[model samples]
Target: MVQKPTLAAVTHQPLARWIAYLNAVITFKTPQGMRLTNQDLTHQGHTVRATICHVGPEPADGTMLYLHGGAFMIGDLRMYRHLVARLGQAARQRAYFLHYDRAPEYPFPAALDQATTAYLALCTDPAAGPISLVGDSAGGNLVFALLHRICTRDLPRPAAVAAMSPVVDLRMRAKSLTTNRRTDHLVPTSWARRGCTAYMGSADPMNPEVSPVLGQFDGAPPCLIQADETEMLADDSRAMAAALQAQGVQVDLQMSKGLIHVWHLNVGRSPEADASVAEIGRFLRGVTSRETV
Candidate 1:
């Protein structure tokens, strides 16, 4: 079974409301060799809270938003600070961690709307030049959704997009859900099914707005996808890559063996995680370099 809050417990316990916030606070410590500064931006009549993670004193190559993953319902800026900091160090760029609204209170398009507003604001900011987008899990879903919006609505496209262990199909039709059931412990097909029902609430699972794998990727930016070979959602990344490629979008998909879902979050502790970050950095560099040239 997937590790998550039970409905009965959440309904009875008022303290359950503060769990994500508490986790964010408890896990937050200044990552070694990194600096963090908080910033608040007003966008689309909403207060978008974010943090700028810097690795060095000098200016970075560019700016990229680091979207966190918690099935679109949980997660906070603090929980992802270190990972974003390490990403900043690897990509040679500043990482802006967006703390957007979550679901079941904010449900359906709320998170997507908040993220889109914040990203649009970032694109307009001269300081956050040549922006890119990277995310894991649900955040990866947002990244791809945003890309679809960018293509369909003529919004500014990011320099590149990288998603790790993205939940591309909310319907969970992939065969891996059954085949990798025993191998992938962190996420069970049942948990994802419940999450989709709650997070999507009335939204069609096949809608590109909800399941980005069904979205149009034509004219989208260059993309990179990484997935754990053993995870239930392993095929999510593969399916998304094929969709992007079919739409003529350049894509690179890397499958890592035996790693847990979003193992990149274990950076500084896992060698495999460290290598993944480095590979992402290299991919981003190649994309940005080609864009400039």
Candidate 2:
């Protein structure tokens, strides 16, 4: 594995500070032509809130369920409003972004349950078409685990999945975890390990649901993973891709250099971010392989 040289990327603000800032950032109106609805859904007795964003004319067929990344701590539907809006735009459909529970208060199966219920709800919705699951960082972990669980528990799997800089391996044992430690501005090695420990509670770190690297995935949905050359979880995506392919899952992997984890949030400031989004848009187009809405 060739390590890319690190860049002085901008450090993400602390969770609280960033959340406060986000509250004031989107006050300005969005594109008038686009319409996005925001709300919540009841899943397994949990009121999992979600923001529904629409991109095209109206009545979108397929839907992509989005899970935001926050190291299993911060981040929610409101925090990722802009990104969800873009996903709606990218797919020319509506996106339902899940605001699942975070760690400490509600960890492990809590988010998993929310994801499962969300998918089930979508499958029942009238507008449902070929569905997809998308997530970043810990959310990526949920996406992978969701697929495995859906298969194991006989739930419906999505048409495909696209994960960006996902932390599939919660044990923090990926080779890139050590090699890219100094390069990734999004996650420090200590922080990654610490987050894993907190999220796991008493559960085993390698429990496929807790950390998907150990999970069995056969006949899994087609998967596309995007990672950065410098992110600690670069190997997380790589290892999952190799495993998914070995199991005969259609897989597409792209690694962008000198970027941090889930750099898609940098869509406005960094060319790398836009490039990642473009590739994602292309990947979605290919996976769906259907006509426009």
lDDT of 2 by residue, 1-293 (tens): 21122111212335443643465265323434555576766655656667786654653446789987877766665456667667656765568888787776776788888888888888777667778889988889899988888877777667778998888887777899889887887576655665566577788877888878677777677788999888888899999888788778889898888876777776545677767777776677666655234
- List ranges where model 1 is wrong by over 4 Å: 1-30, 43-46
- Each prediction's RMSD to truth: 2.7, 4.9
Clashes (backbone N, CA, C under 3 Å), per candidate, total: 0, 0
lDDT for predicted candidate 2 compared with the true structure: 0.73
| Residue 292 lDDT in candidate 2 | 34
Our model 1 lands, by Cα RMSD against the true structure, at 2.7
For lDDT, the strongest prediction is 1
* Maximum-TM-score candidate: 1
Candidate 2: residue pairs that collide: none
lDDT of 1 by residue, 1-293 (tens): 32433422343223433665575565444566688899876666766878987775554567788888877766676678888888877887778899877777777788888788888888878876667899999999999988888888988888999999999898879999899988986775655666677789889888897999999876788899999889988989999999999999999999988988898877777788889988998888777766656
Candidate 2 residue runs with Cα over 4 Å from true position:
1-35, 43-47, 56-61, 290-293
